[model samples]
Target: MLVVKHLSGEYEQRDPRTKAYATKVKDASLSFETFELSQIGRENNGRADALSRIASAETQSLTGSIYLTEAKMPSIEKRECLEIHQGTDWMTPLKNYLEKGILPMDRREALKIKYRASTYTIINGRMYRRSVSQPLLRCLNTEEQHQALEAVHEGICGEHLAGRSLAFKILRQGFFWPTLKADASEYAKKCVQCQLFATVPRQPPEEMTSVLSPISFAMWVVDIVGILPTSMKQAKYCIIAIDYMTKWVEARPLSAITEEAAKKLFLEHIIL
Candidate 1:
């Protein structure tokens, strides 16, 4: 069911391998004037299901190894990206003082460096910061900071958390840089996906006072969902009618909504 929906583009493909397959399928389908995907049960799919079951069970019936090649690395790692060359950064001064007992010439600056470097330690040539709440946080350079923030904010497990939450998550993940909070705020604000699906603040944005309904249907509330992306049936708005007492909800879709349409929906779906 899901495979058919993904092929038809009714549902989004999120898995890397499945998304790749979907793209290839759509591209190959472009050659045909008409194309359709249908769900064929295993019973009607001939020996294909049997072959898959055999393959999954690791029962080799034939030499399919003729078509196989041992991959040296994963497919995800095959891409080329610019290598980040590590260099002098905010960590340079502190690292220098911590590792080599080096300090600036200025008396006040040298004392400052001495105090600051005391909170850090090097293990296996990597710097880590002392933390009271959790384990040592691994100090990051410019490149490491970018990589950590990217992976945490938009990686597989990421939920596109807000600024402070994003920073807190990174801290929990045991990474830190001087500008962590500021960078997290900036990154979350600029995230295209976050903006697209962001929640629309409902009316009565402030706290609501509870009202005592005299009866089950005595008090009611009405809300309109959107003038949103039109659906295939061309519905652009959703009207919801709710009874305050029983909390029963009746919702209906609308294309061109008017007071009359709202009235009819409430009468038919709710009152009836």
Candidate 2:
């Protein structure tokens, strides 16, 4: 029933997000003789939610007297920014031309800078180039380009995309460099994992997944969804059964996870 694991000592709450709210609840609970917290689904809690909304919305419309208070400040502190030194790179000429009208002494180069600056704009000290599909593409300096390449190719959520695809993906994410595609290609070529997992043996049109054939509506998998908000009927969990081959799914809301509840759902929904 306890959603705040740290407050109940079930587990140490390391998440700053929930821990802050949970701490306030724990402090307030001292005023009560006995207090308990339970999670319920939105379907059952809609009545109370609607009441709160009415109390907060259009107070003038309601003849009944009501007073509301709003929090003036954010719950979390502002994120800290890291200080880094940024030296000039290929974009310097374009940025200078656009911001300050600075141009190279060479007449030929100055004309080129004017043409390039037409495609770029500075926003809050950051440069962005005009894009057709996207409104703006963020211009990255040398250091930032490296970070972007590493992040897109090898960072936590990275899929280790090949050279050309990796470059396009970074562009899609609104980042750009003078040699983005070339750099991405070189970075991918140097990546250890990319080298190890390089696509090979072009016999089949696509890489084969499994040799064994699977039958439709045969094997199934079951999973429990959560300790959700408690419903008026006291249900807070969802049990789901999915057919692997057919991709058919069935679900039932439950108050608690139990063998009998699972069996009941299986008998009623899946087996039948």
State which candidate has the highest lDDT: 1
- Stretches of candidate 1 exceeding 4 Å from the true structure: 1-87, 204-272
Q: Can you give the TM-score per candidate against the true fold?
A: 0.44, 0.43
Which residue pairs in candidate 1 have backbone atoms (N, alpha carbon, C) closer than 3 angstroms, thus clashing? none
Error of 1 at 241 (Å): 41
lDDT score for residue 131 of model 1: 71
lDDT of 1 by residue, 7-37 (tens): 9888988898888777777888999999988
Model 2 lDDT tens row, 1-272: 35745677787777887787777778789999999876677789887787777745787786655556675665554557988876678988888888899999999999998888888899999999896668799999888999999998989999999899999999989898889989999999999997788886769888779533288667878899999999899999999888887778998999988999999987888779
* TM-score result, candidate 2: 0.43
User: lDDT per model, in order?
Assistant: 0.85, 0.85
State residue 137's C-alpha deviation in candidate 2, in Å. 0.9
